[model samples]
Target chain A: MHELSIAKNIIEIVKESVEEKDLSEVDKVVLKIGDLSGVVPASLLFSLEAITNNTELENAGYEVINVPFIVKCNTCGKESNNEAGIVRCTLCGSNDTGIISGNELLVSEIILKN
Target chain B: MSVITVERKILAKNDEIAEQNRELLKQNDVFTINLVSSPGSGKTSLLEKTISLIGSKVNISVIEGDVQTSLDAERVANYNVPVVSIVTNGACHLEAKLVQDAINNLDLAKTELLFIENVGNLVCPAGFDLGEEMKIVVVSTTEGDDKPLKYPKMFRNSDVMIINKIDLIPYVNCDISKLKDNALLINPGLKIFEVSCTSGEGIKEWCNWLIENVKGKYIHQTQLVY
Candidate 1:
């Protein structure tokens, strides 16, 4: 799965942060995974756990903040949370809508151990 | 005890490389398309058809991405076009760095359009940007009409959706209308084309649209240059 690569990417980012901040160890890594990001949180967490084994991040807990897919209808100026993952206006029935959120795949925070 | 604020994209490295590629392609006046699909969704077949139809009118090059083997590259080479194959070894998708490497091997000056046949997987490729002008997702009738709904991210991310293998529609359980409806629901702005690579059904329309796009890009570039 691509999550393996994503997990490795997260570790790389964390490692860079650690080096720059002079942190001893990582306690947890916080991620913001959106519904439309095409990433499965469980699979990504599993990959992180497996790869972090025997490494400095072995005991680091992974925190994923689930973000719902929301869209803003340009026609009606109505915002709707689309659980079905479709980008459509709920009120004005306009297809011309922009994604308000939900495509995020970012590392928001990293907790360092004392 | 301390929480470090790091609001950064996990695929920032890839995105950076992708942006570099976009700049590079723009400078070279090369219009690129990243073709993505399931393992057996006839991506190669569609490419073969596209090349054959438009090769005489325009200059084309190809970068074939596969987990292993140079089979697709060999197939594309039969058309006498400049082709490069990127064997990911075991990677599920083609990253921007890999594509950047492939771009270095092609003659972009002579290439009007570059077709990157991405590794055959709908999910992972949707997330990775290879600096293509557009991403085209191919879905065959045999895969069923629910593909768009099942893999909404691919449909949503793709600018163009090519419904391939329409020749098998009579035997398959897929409803073409339903598939279009589902895809349109996910992405209302998607440009769709239905084609049968074997029967040469809608290849002309696809090629005409492609040529128009290439010409449009060329004209835009010329305008900027002047």
Candidate 2:
């Protein structure tokens, strides 16, 4: 699945940050994925587990936090949730809206050993 | 155990390189488009038709992305235009770093229009930005009308959604109006085009929109791009 590639990229990102911080090993990583991000969390974790095994970061655990999609109507300037894949305005019933959040794919934290 | 807040986007590295690509294309005055779609959505066919219709008037080049095979590149090459192929091996989507590498292999500066045909998958391609002026997602009538609600992220991120294979509409059990309404419900401002690559029904308007968005020719039109 495509989640494996994303998991690999996460490893790369962690590697870069770990190297930059001069950390010897990683213990845990925190990821915040938005509802509209198009990522399947279970599949991503499955790939992460398979990847971290038998490696220097073998003991590393991952935590994924799901985020909700929110949008603001461009016409009425009203903010609302868009998790169900509907991009309409909550107040004026206008479909003209811009998504303000919920497409996140961030690596927010890295638990490391001294 | 110590927790350090990295607060970094997992695809930040991709976005970082994408910025560099935008700068490179901006310097060249090239109008770049990242064309994305599900497999067998006629993305290649649309490009071939587009090139055939207006390739002579404009210096258009394409970077074709497929999991395996250079066949798509060969198809575009039949039009006597510059085309490069990026074989992703088994990856489902194309990344910006790969596109940056591909651009290095092409002469984008002299080209007026550059189309990056992304790997044929709707889900993964929406997440990666490849330094393009805009992203265009092509869906076929056979894919059904509920795709907008099914694959919301792709439609949400795309500036234009080209519903291809309209000629097959009569043969398929699909509602074209439902597709349009559903797409707009997901992205109200999504410029949509119903085109038949087989009969070349709506190629002119699409080409006109591309021409208008061309470098130094962009005069932001309030109306949708046909």
Candidate 3:
């Protein structure tokens, strides 16, 4: 799955960061995956485990924080979470809007031990 | 003896590579299209039809991304055009780094149009940018009309939506209007085309639009030199 490739990238990023900081082991990897990012946290973790085997992050635990999609309605000036993928304003029901957040796939923090 | 908090995005490296790929394509005056769809959505067939219609006039090359077999690359090879297949080895999508490598392996000097056919998947590919000029999403009528609503991100990211297998509409119950409506709802400026690759219906218009867009951009760039 694509998760494997994503996981591979995660490993590389973590490896580089750990090496740069001269850390010997990775304790945990915390990720923030947005609802609209189209990534499944469980699948990503599974792939991470398989790929990180025998690596410095082999014992590293994964923590996934789900980020809900939020949008701002331009016409109604309403801010709300857009779980349904609808762009309409909740108050005025106008289709005009702008995405405030979500669609993010990022490594929020990495814990490394000396 | 201390714990360091490293706050960084895992995809930062991949995104950096993708931006480099974008710059390379832009500098080469080449138009690249990353075509994404579900398996059996007539992606290769559409490419076949497209080559048959416009290959002689335009310089086209293809990079076929698949999880395993080279079957799709083999199909494009018959056209006598340059094609490179990158087997993902069970990966569901193509990343920017892979595309960058594929481009380096090919001859970009003679290529005007480069097509990267991504591994057939609706979700993951939407998140990764391959540094293409545009993203074309293919959804056949047989796959149903609710795809836009179900997979809104893919539809929203795509610049064009190709509704394939229109010939099968008679045998299957699919609402073309609903598909267009839903896609338009996601992206108001999305250009859509309904075609049947097997029957050669509407293929001409599709190819013509592609050529015109590319050539138009080329001409516009050339005019700026003076």
Candidate 3: global Cα-lDDT? 0.83
Tell me how far candidate 2 lies from the true structure as C-alpha RMSD in angstroms.
3.0
Q: Model 3: which docking level applies? A: medium
In model 3, which residue pairs have backbone atoms overlapping below 3 Å?
A: none
Q: In model 1 chain A, where is the ten-residue run with the lowest total lDDT?
A: A17-26
Q: How many residue pairs clash in each candidate?
A: 0, 0, 0
| DockQ scores for all predicted structures | 0.81, 0.72, 0.55
Residue A107, model 2: lDDT of 93
Error in Å for residue B215 of model 3: 0.5
Best by lDDT: 1
Task: Give the lowest summed-lDDT range of ten residues in model 1 chain B.
Answer: B217-226
lDDT of each: 0.91, 0.87, 0.83
Fraction of native contacts (fnat) of each candidate: 0.84, 0.85, 0.60
Error of 3 at B72 (Å): 1.5
Least well predicted 10-residue stretch by lDDT in candidate 3 chain A = A16-25
| Ranking according to DockQ, highest score first | 1, 2, 3
> For candidate 3, lDDT tens digit of each residue in A54-90?
8656788888988888778888788988654555555
lDDT of 2: 0.87
TM-score of each: 0.95, 0.92, 0.90
Best by TM-score: 1
Residue A46 of model 3 has an lDDT of 94
DockQ measured for candidate 2: 0.72
Question: How far does residue B114 in candidate 1 sit from its true spot (Å)?
Answer: 0.3
